[model samples]
Each structure stands twice: as C-alpha cells, then as structure tokens.
Target: MVRAKSIDHGIPGRGSFMPMRDSIPRRADRDTLRRELGQNFLQDDRAVRNLVTHVEGDGRNVLEIGPGKGAITEELVRSFDTVTVVEMDPHWAAHVRRKFEGERVTVFQGDFLDFRIPRDIDTVVGNVPFGITTQILRSLLESTNWQSAALIVQWEVARKRAGRSGGSLLTTSWAPWYEFAVHDRVRASSFRPMPRVDGGVLTIRRRPQPLLPESASRAFQNFAEAVFTGPGRGLAEILRRHIPKRTYRSLADRHGIPDGGLPKDLTLTQWIALFQASQPGYAPGATGTRIPGQGGGAGGRDYDSEPNRAAVPGGRRYGPTRGGDPCAPRAQVRQTKGRQGARGSSYGRRTGR
Candidate 1:
C-alpha cells in the first residue's frame, strides 16, 4: 500500500496552515534548476491536472519521465495509486525521493530510454525530456502493454504529430497505429524557469490493429528515409534509386499511376493502389488521365488544355527564346566608318564645286 506525505510548503507569508493551491507551486530558484536540466519545470498545477486527466487508465501503475523537483510528481502522487518516476539526474532523483518519501511515488534514477518499463503499467504520464522526446515516444509505442499516454512535449513536435495532412513521417506512420490528440497548449511562462518556446500536451492512444504489416514496416522505413531526403521530388523518383527498377515500374504501371509520384495529399487508397500496382504486369494508360482502379491514366484534370494559356515572349513556349525583351525600346544603330566618310566626302565635293 502507498503512503501519503505532507507537502513541504516552504513559502513564507501564508498562514502556518494553508491548503495547497492546485495552481503552480513556486520554485525556490527556477533559473538554477533550469540550468541543471536544460529545461524549465512545468509549475502550473492546472496543466498538470489536465495532463493527468487525459490518461485513460485508473492510475494503478503510472510511469513519469523527467519528474524534475516533483513539480508534476506532487500532484500525481496524490491522485494515482502508484507512480514511478524516471529521473536521469541523480540529484533530482534524490530530492524527489526525499520530498515524497511517504507518498506513493517510486523514483528510478536513469534515462527513460535505457530503463526497462515496469510490468503492468496502466498509464504513462510525464513531461518527456526535450532532448530525447521522439526516442522516448518511439520506445513507448514499441511497448505493447501500456494502455495510453499523456505527454507534455515541445509545442512544435506536438503540433506536427496532431496536425492534419502532410505531417512528418514519424507522425504519419505512427498515426495509423495510434490515435493522437492535442489536449492543451501550456504557456512558456508556466514553467519555473520559463522555456523559450511554449509547450503542449499530447494524448495518444494505441490502435486496436497495427497499421502496417511487419514486412511493410522495413519498406515504410526505407520510403520515409527517401521521402525526407528529397521532399520536393516525386516519391517514385526518390524511391527508384534505392529500390529495383522492375519493382518501381511495376508499382507505377499497375496503379496506372504517373511516374511523377504521390502528392502530399495522397490518400491511403492511393498508397494501396501503388502497392498493388507494384505487382507484375501493370500497364499505365497512355492518355495520362487518372482513372480510379484503371491502372495507368492520369488521375486528375489536365491543365495543359486550359484556355488563354499564357504565351511565352518571343513566341518561344516551352524553352528558351532567341530574342531580348519585346517591351523594351529598340536602340538605333549609328552609321560609322565607311558610311560617315561617304557623307562627309559628298558634302566636301558639293561645297568645292
């Protein structure tokens, strides 16, 4: 059974006995603490509660990362059945244990990535380390046991993960495997030593069935690697060099897809079509019109036939032209040498006669 401990109210001014406010607990020295951890602590009590609320479990077993000075840890211990915190800094871990000795909090002094997740954790909640947030998240996803997670991360990362369409590959790939939502955006000032940028809380729940097949996982990894390296080019072009031409051509032809590749807005069906088309004997139609399930016609309306197609200057439509700007004033060529001598001679002879 977990024990409860009296929260150390070190603040002076308030009466000897005052109830702890759910607001952020003031830090003794925020700047120094921030310097130690390379980040500020989330001191807002309301934000902490909101984050904890997002966790779906009954809070029987919870994992907290980077529980700095027990800012969020204080509130978590009060609400949860058992809380295990992973703190890399030994000093902070010691302080946490001492501060919440009687409380139902266990402190593990190590990096979260290296530490083994405890068995049977119903929920995982924490303000993840900024330096290794993605690695930590990936680690969590790899673990099949946890029911859900609520994490406070860099606002940008959170936004990318929860954003609609054209998100990062990490976000998009994992999205199919998990449900991600933004709970709230915590202000930068909410921390003891405020961070330069604001942070946000993201709630992610595992999907019932994994999105990609085991065989496809490696392929997806390779695909993502290629796409990120050359984001502006067609997906097929980027992938062609890494994969076999036959495989690439088969995928494109079978889908009746253009070699130009998938657009940023390509749907899951389009992706599946490409996969299907990669099979043997796929022929893309010559008309270059995209027909659903037709395998090789262009998929969208052709812009090449648009009326009032802007003409290129110098009558050169597709390539470079031979002339200069048509709008500029033309320069007159002055007669020199022989022409000037002839004019002068005629005037001299007429004058002499």
Candidate 2:
C-alpha cells in the first residue's frame, strides 16, 4: 500500500479537502458511472498522492482532465493556486463543484477534447478515464499552453507513450519538444473498480530548449510520418533506397545504424540526427532514389486516402487524414466502434497515440 503524505503551502485560510472516506456513491451508483463513462474511479488516497507527486505542481495553474470524485483534485487545490477540472460526467462534476465550492477549484462538465484550455494554465494533471485517454492526450500534447503534465493511464499505453523498448511514430513526432517518463505502475487493485490492466503514472515535460523550432514542427511531423510509413524491408534499407544512396550510406555509417535496423529501434538522438541529415539543403543531391524490386513509395503515399488503403512494411499502415485542429485530432482514429483503452479495444492503438 502506498502512503499518502500531506503538503503544507503556507496559504492562510486555504487548504485541501477530501470527501469523507465513505462519501463516494454506493455500489449501485458506481456501477452506473462505470457503464456510462466506461471507466473505474481511482479511489486510493496513496495512489492519488503518488500522482500529485509526479505532477510536480509548484504553484502553477493546473487543468485536470478528469476529477472523478475529486481524489486527485483535492491534492491539486492544495498544491496549486488554480485547479480547473474538465469532467465529462455531470453528476461527478456537480459533486466536485459542491465539494470544492469556495476554493480555487472550477469544475466544468464537458468533453475535454472540445473544452478550451485557459490561457494561464501552465500544467495539466489527472487520472483520466481510460475510455477517452487517446483523445485527451492528443488535446493536451497539441495545446501549447501547458509546460508539463502527469497522467494516470493503462500500463501498456504508458509504456508505449514513454517509448520503452521502442518508440512510436507519435512519440517520435513529439520527442523534439517534449520528454516522457513513466514514474510508476499502480496495480489494478488500487482503484475502486479494478481495471483489467494496471495503471501507470506518466509525466511529460517540455524541454527548456527544444531541439526543433516550432516553425519546423509541421515539417518534422510530416517527415516522421513519411519515414515510419515508407516502404522497405527495414529503416536502414528504406533509407538506402529512399534518399541518395551515397548520403544514406554515409548517415548509416556515421550513426552506426545496422542495415537491418527498424525505425522503432533507433534512439531519440539518432532520429534527430537522421532528420537533420534528410533536410532538403542540409545534404546536396538528396533527391529520392527507387529500388529495383520495391513498390513505389518513398514518400509517395497520400495521407488523405481511405482507411486501411495504404500499407507499409512491418505490418504498419498509414492512417487517414484528420480534417481540423492538426494537434487535437489524430492522423487517423483507428477503431471507430469502441472506446480507446477499453478491454480488447484497439482504438488509436495503430497510431500509438
């Protein structure tokens, strides 16, 4: 069991408040919430404390994605001067409003994806519902107001987002500006309604000095998406035929990338160096080359094609284009039928959002 610790911030007449240990709704209400939201409430005080610690809120304004019953929200109010929670469930939003009524808490009942984040908000923290984890994450990562965020999500999702073992295209696309870390994994038993999978505390902090400028962010994203979805046997092999063969060989030799290495297998620094090397003017004679036997696509695939029409090597496929808000919407919403992070659900799993 994790131990819950109290924090004192020397604010007169202002402090945090937790609903009575028994104040949560009865089992019947819990069941209804579960059905409606497709999520289990995080009830462990210790886990809440752990999440707060991971957030590193040092008096900055915070926007919490979901505050179901205010377990984590209570801690935020104590640590930060402003705590605004975006809750999808009206019942729980009303409950949290009444609980933190007079304090710095502002509860808004709405989909976090559609809700406009405040200008002064500097940090985001929450134990977000698993059902909409992908959507919420996209919204947060795309928004530029927040400098850091701590999120509690499904274990595998956390691991992938943090780029454990290998990186995803989404992680690679954003790695130029943000840093991801997996703090700890809480067991499924930690929540009031145990999830089939454990939960992980993940944090994302923007770098003080980003490697790539914001002006180049879109180019970098398009480059990453192209590379990940480009055709060839492996990353090195793909590069060999995609770029000028001499330049590709030089990069491989300089970076020590083996001929059979995959895109996901490359390190963050290597990916940066590679992207730098692939720029139009960075290296001369960098027009793309075609392999004799390979199918035609060295950045030739249209990003706006129909679903599942464009397939890449290694069982990877390019997703369809999202029309508006490049930051908020994914390149593609993989599964339209089920909630993301649901049991056996693959919604947004392909994009690794």
Candidate 3:
C-alpha cells in the first residue's frame, strides 16, 4: 500500500466562480475574483479526452474539483462507477446536479479546499486555476486519501512538476513519494475563454515504494527546503554545510554533479540520496529504483504516445478519427508554428503526465 505523506503547497478554476454570461465569459467582472479564479473552461473534446485518459490509480470512485459546466463530468460518468464533483459556484453546482441527475455523480457545492476528501478517495481530477494551483496541490498531498491525480495547470508549472526541462524544489521534494508526468499541452484556444498561458495535463501517482518512511517526510521536506533556500554559490557549498565533504564528494561522483551544480539541479534520485545520507545512519531503501524513460534526473515527460487512436465520447468521431475508447490512447493533431489551425492535445501512459 502507498503510504500517505503530507507537505505544505495551484489552482485550476477558482473556488468561487463568477456568474454565468449570456455567452462565454468576458473580461468584465463584477468581482475581481472572476478572472483571478480561472474562468476558462475546457471546450475542446481532445483535451477533455486527454485529461480523463491520464487519470492514474485503480478505483471506482473519483473526486472531481471544479467541474465547470460538466465538460469533464459528461465523459467521467460513462467510465467510472461513481463521480463526486465539487464546485464552488452554486449555479454551476446546481446545474451539474440537474445535468447528471441520473448519472452516478455526487455534486457538492463548496470550495474544494474546504471540502473534506474521503479517506477512501483514490483519485481526483480538475482543470484548476493557475493562481491557486500550489495551494490545491498542498491539500491533495496532505489528504489522508487519494492515490493519483490528473490536473490541467499552467504549462510552466506542468513542465516543472514533471522536471521535463529540469528539476525544481517541488518535484525534488515530492519525487521520492510520488511520480509526476506531463501528458500533453492544452492550448489556450481549447478553452471557451482563452487564458493567457496554455494549459498542460499533469498527472500524479503515489510511488508504490517510498524512498523514506512517512514519519520522515516532514524532516525530509525541511532538509530539502533548507538546501533550496540556503545561502550558497552552488550545491557544493550549500550541501557541504549539511554533510561531510567526503559524503558530498561521494554523492556528487555517483550522480555526476558538475563542478557547481545548484540545488535545483539535483534530480529526484539525488534528493533521496542526500536526504538518506543526512540521517544518523545512512542506508538505502529496497525501491530507490529509477523510473524508466527518465534519462538522468529529468522527469518522464510523454508529449507523444502511440501513432494515433480514436478519442471521443460514444462511437462518434469528433476530431480526426473515432473507433475505440476516448481515453484509450494519446492522439491529437495540430500544426507546429506561427499560426496553426488549432492546438493539439495528446495523452500518454507513463510515470509522468
């Protein structure tokens, strides 16, 4: 069983959404919060299928945060046994209830942050507001339940969380306990009201074997925070302040750290090693095994997976092709350049999104 570990932490859609418009939402807002909370809702079928496809863990129940307009809910009910959706907007909450009255979905009208996640909830999904993404992530990580997640967040956040470009303090700290992956990039145009930055499908799954015990998570996070915020020119100086030069050299050589690798440079593997070494008696866990496809310290980012497959609700072909399950494979078509027709959406089955 995966051990539950909590850490202090975004957001996709805002908890309190704005009043609906005659048409799509606009820049005009009675309350400044309307825009701040993330009003852009997923409108593209490909993105919807991709987001649902990346969901991890095995469970009949799913807790959906901010089911705006029931775009995701429509497809979720078809596959999952039970779908519990939490929406901050009363209008949308009521709408979702009426929309899926017969479906196996429970609608809760309140802030997801305030709602208590059941201990048995194994998975959660959402298209969160980029502003509060970090805060929401903290809540999920701290929850006593929930094993996997599929979220639509800012592109940069998704990239950093997956360590596709490099590693970050967030990924470094959580990497030991969870596996993050980037399924695909959601273009801003895919949403009804386009957002400034494009969205990315980010998936998170609890590691089957944690590098450290649940009891050590708090201390380990603190150590990681220290190294990240500590004053030092490079990782060498910062890490040297905590461990002996001998141990530092050993780790550096093992991980092949360059002369002046910084704290952010360390991958999940290096972070685990450093944390374990800091303990009174250094020892290795049975499952420090590296994740496949993630060359070096980078995350396993799956931007492309399979040649192409049908991904649409029912048997109807929505985009490009249609036949098999909508969430079966990652396939979306898009031109890469200055002015493309529409944004491409794809999903992949891997450790990262």
- Please report the candidate that would top lDDT against the real structure: 2
Superior candidate under TM-score, 1 versus 2? 2
TM-score of each: 0.61, 0.73, 0.72
Best by TM-score: 2
Question: Across residues 1-353, which tens digit of lDDT does each residue of candidate 3 receive?
Answer: 12211111122233332233223333354234456556678999988998998886575889888888899988787667788787776556666777787677777665665555654567899999787787677546545467789999999889888888877655665666677988799999998778888999999887665544444555566677678777888888888777778877776787776648787777666776676666665543322334445544211112113214321111212221234321111112112211210111111001222
Misplaced by over 4 Å in model 3 are 1-33, 283-353
Q: List clash counts for every candidate, in order.
A: 11, 0, 17
Worst 10 residues of 2 by lDDT: 310-319
Ordered by TM-score, highest first, the candidates read: 2, 3, 1
lDDT winner, 2 or 3 = 2
Which scores better on TM-score, 1 or 3? 3
**Model 1 lowest lDDT segment of ten:** 311-320
Query: What does candidate 2's lDDT look like per residue over 154-181, in tens digits?
Result: 8888898898858877677777678899
Give candidate 2's error at residue 91 in angstroms: 0.5
How many pairs of residues collide in model 1?
A: 11
